[model samples]
Structure formats: C-alpha cells, structure tokens
Target: MKNSFIFLFLLYSTILFSQKTTDYLLDKKEISQRELNSLSNFPIYKAYEFSDKGGVYNLVLGENQQKITKKDTLNTKIKAICAMNDHGGFLEKWSINDLLEAYEPKETNIWFWTKYCTLKDLDGDGYIEPIIVYGSKTEYGEVRRVKIITVYKNKKYVIRAVECDLDYCRSFKKDAAWNTLPQKVKTYVDQLVIKLRKEQNLLLKDG
Candidate 1:
C-alpha cells in the first residue's frame, strides 16, 4: 500500500507540472509573451454525454453506425458556444471592438472590466496594475504597450513602474499609451476622459 500511494502521488505531480496554459485564439498553442487578457478565454473540451443546456452540440457517431444529436432543430435549439459561457447573454453576437466601446465607467464597474482589463502584480510592488486588452483579432488584437501614471493621496510619491512591454510600460513617457493604440482604445479612454498624469493620476470615478 505504501509503494502504491507513492507511485500515485508521483504520477499526479508529473501530470500537473507537464501541462501548460494555452490561448484558443492562436494556432501555435504556445507563445513567448504572456498576456493577462488570455485569462478570460479559457479552454473548452468536447467529450461524451449530451447536455441540453450547453451551447455547443454535434452529432455523435458510435459503433454499429449510430447517429446521435442533442436537439432536433438547429436554428431554434442550438446555441452559440460563447453564448452559454463567459458571455452574459448576447455576448455571442458582440466582438472585441464592441466590448472596448461598451466599457462605460458608470454602467460597468471594475469587476466588469476584467473581461477586457486584467489586473496583475508583475512588478512585485504589492499593487496590482491594470493591463488593458483592446481587441480580439488573430493577427493584432492585444495591445503591446500601455501607460503607467503615478497616483498620489496627498502629494506623497508612489512606487515606480518596473515592468513594461517596452519603454511605453515605463513611467513618464509622453504619448506612450497612444503609441501602441488598439482600434477603439483611444476613443474608449477619451470618452471616459481619464486624467492620467506624470506626478499624480486620478482614478475615473464611477458616474
């Protein structure tokens, strides 16, 4: 029994360490640059058993040439895979552009922006930085660069930005955020009128 338990533990640990994260949008399955935006897009696998509530379904063929389908009607019964998951209703029809354009500060709060903006503590500064993902295109959807404004409470200096995609990720770079603009990212920020500055930056208060 002791030997059996040790073998099982080793097997489990090996399997867990062997697996790596993936992004369905990319064909290669592996990339050097790790982006926080990939968190929202998780992996989905198709296996046995039929679920009526699920959005994705297909005809299954087994031994003896049997045909199995979840629903009889395709149009009315079948739902988009995205519609059933992550997407809060009608998200199946919307695109990345729609999400960026729809990020209203008052209507959708910080919790809601995780679908587009990801919070990460890559700098080890204790404070999590908001990494905003702009679009959802295969070739060029993710924003390679962004801005880091120093925020203050009462004229006290805050921590500096240590991590960045390039010079843009550094602090006090002029037109840094605008340099690697996503399609609607400029308009989206402009619409909100966020006051980001070099010395002190203010958060966009919920309207």
Candidate 2:
C-alpha cells in the first residue's frame, strides 16, 4: 500500500507540472477596448494594443507628441507591458520610453519592432518574460539605433546598438545584469540580435 501511494503521488506531480508548462506558453491575442481602459492611468495619448493570454498580459504601446515650437515637435513613445495572474492580480509592469529629437528637415522616425517583441516562460517559472524591441532612425535610414528590453521577474535587461553606414560605425552595449540571466535567456536574446542585424543589412556580427 505504501509503494502504491508513492507511485500515485509522483504521477500526480508529473501531471501537474506538465499542465503548468502548457499553461504558461505564450500566444498572441487580439486587443480590446476594455483592456485599454484598464491602462488609462498611463499616458495613452495614442495607443496600440498587443494584449495576449486571455488578458494575462496587457501589453500596449502608447505614443504622444510634445510641441516644442511652431515648426518643431518632439515625439515620445512608451511601451507598457504588464503581466497578471489568472485572477487579474498584477505581477509586474515593464515600462520604457523613448524621445525623438524635435522635428526638423532631417525626418526622424521612432517605433516599436512589434514583430520581435515576444512573451515566453523561458525558465518555466509559470510567469512569462516579456522581450520588447524598438528603434529610431533617420528618414533615409542612414543612421539607426535599436534597443532590446526584457524583463524576468522584476528585473530588466537591456541591449542598445547603433548602426551607421554613413560613417561605417557599429556598436552595442549590454546591461551589467545581462550576465545574470539564465543561459537559455541569453541565447534567445543573441538570436534576436542576429535577426535584427540581418534585417538592417549590418555586416558586423554581434559581439
């Protein structure tokens, strides 16, 4: 009887773990106005929604313009990626903002690389890590800068890179905490860096 009980307990544990693994897997979902209202406390002048997992994540992109002068306006962009439990209790919120120089003849553009932004339970912690990427570049795409931001638990890791064909300059910076992330997470970020480089026609490999 004791042996049977032990076997059944182990089997139940295994099944529970499997179910959790499946539940934490991320999937894309359509955005809804109700979800946007929940984030009204944020500075959401103009917003784009990327909600997912039955409202478990209220990821959104908020944008606004600040008028500096009659001929010049500064553009501000924000990303608010929030994680919540099944009961709608907030777990963590990752917010980032970027400001573009006042408008000029140079023509600057700033935007989130929405296709690269992803949510995953890379460590199987039953909570998803959000990876967000954005960039700003000149009108002709001569000089470009990209930023990759990812949050694990309440900690954030970032990578900043600049690519310029006009001056043949390429460089990148990693946050000091980057090395603290799990090997699997590091590998995932590296792969994304490679993809972003390729898309921009960068010749130098990521260091």
TM-scores for the candidates: 0.21, 0.69
- Per-residue lDDT tens digits for candidate 1, residues 68-137, read 3573211111111212123322223111111111211211111111233322232333332223321111
- Candidate 2 C-alpha lDDT tens digits along 7-47: 99999988766543222322223334335535534344333
Score candidate 1 by TM-score against the native.
Answer: 0.21
lDDT for predicted candidate 2 compared with the true structure: 0.61
Off by over 4 Å in 1: 26-207
- The clash number for model 1 is 0
Score residue 4 of candidate 1 by CA lDDT. Answer: 100
Q: Once model 2 is optimally superposed onto the true structure by TM-score, how far is the C-alpha of residue 50 displaced, in angstroms?
A: 10
**Candidate 2 Cα misplacement greater than 4 A, ranges:** 1-4, 20-30, 40-55, 65-75, 83-92, 101-107, 166-170, 203-207
